[model samples]
Target: MDSEVRSYRTGGDEVVLDLTRDAADFVSGRGDGLLQVFVPHATAGIAVIETGAGSDDDLLAALGDLLPADDRWRHRHGSAGHGRSHVMPAIVPPHCTVPVLGGTLALGTWQSICLVDLNVDNAERQVRWSFLAA
Candidate 1:
């Protein structure tokens, strides 16, 4: 097993960041295994979806509909509707696992790894990448 942590500045807005290239790079030449992407944050999550085809925005939109950023949350703190960010993990999850074949990511043709952040209060995010050889 091998692992490392990488940081990203998500700024003060909701974002869907593509991490496919970096994920691929990390697994490169590592042989068959499993690549686990984990975000160590209460208000963030990892998602595997199609990007650059409006899907990213669509996800955000759907989340907005499901979890409105308003004062209806009980875990109120930081920015408005911040509690929704906490609930997002339940829907999006904080980690995802991808298969590696011969050191390459075994992703679908249109699939991409993305970092989903809904918390506008935190600007810094960290993602832990772990590879376990099979």
Candidate 2:
């Protein structure tokens, strides 16, 4: 298994940062394998969506509707409803395993790997990419 970890600053806002290029770079010149994208955070997740086409915005809206950032979460600690961020992983998940064929990701034409971060309390994030030969 081959792996690498990288960190990014998401600032103090909700965002869907693209990671497709990074993943492709990681697996560059490789053969058949499985690429695992994992976010080492409790208040963040990974998502595959069609960015630059409003899909990313739609996802954030959907998540807001499902997990409103209000003063209802019992796990309250940071900013009001920060606990909701912790619940995000259960809905969006913290990792994704993509198929790599001939050193390229087998994602749909419009699909992209993104970091779904809504936790304003924490702007630092770490993502790990692991590749396993097949």
Candidate 3:
């Protein structure tokens, strides 16, 4: 079975979406060897980051500097906004692959799967998680 998410964010400053529990719970209910987490939005990317206050802020701040949204980017012509957000896909990957061992996700001590939304304002985002046999 696959899980579909209707995600709403309070604000964007390294908000942690602990897919560990969600993924493990899903995997436990089905046959799994590997878990694939995919976010089908160009403005968002997926990564394994430490779920902490400082870490979250650092990640967002770094991303902002890496891809300044206010820069004179040609992609911002259409008033759609989030030109740098589109460029973020080039930085972090669109999906993540984690090994499932003993019917649970194997992650480092502080590692947690996160779906990063780089948009300016809050909008309903989509996150898709699927478990497959290794």
Q: Which candidate comes out best when scored by lDDT?
A: 1
lDDT of 3 by residue, 1-134 (tens): 45555454536443445566676676774544878888888777888998775776788789878877675676774334468777887888789988887677888988888877777554556777777766
Candidate 1 lDDT tens digits, 76-102: 989999999999999999999999999
* lDDT of each candidate versus the true structure: 0.97, 0.94, 0.71
Ranking by lDDT: 1, 2, 3
On a 0 to 100 scale, what is the lDDT of residue 19 in model 1? 97
By TM-score, rank the candidates, best first. Answer: 1, 2, 3
Question: Model 1, residue 128: displacement in angstroms?
Answer: 0.2
- lDDT per residue (tens digit) for residues 7-113 in model 2: 98999988999999999999988899999999989999999989998999999999999999999999999887798999999999999999999999999999999
Superior by TM-score: candidate 1 or candidate 2? 1
TM-score of each: 0.99, 0.98, 0.81
* Candidate 2: residue 104 Cα off by (Å): 0.6
The weakest ten consecutive residues by lDDT in model 1 span 7-16
- The top-ranked prediction according to TM-score is 1
TM-score of 1: 0.99
What lDDT would candidate 2 get against the real structure?
Answer: 0.94
Error of 1 at 28 (Å): 0.3
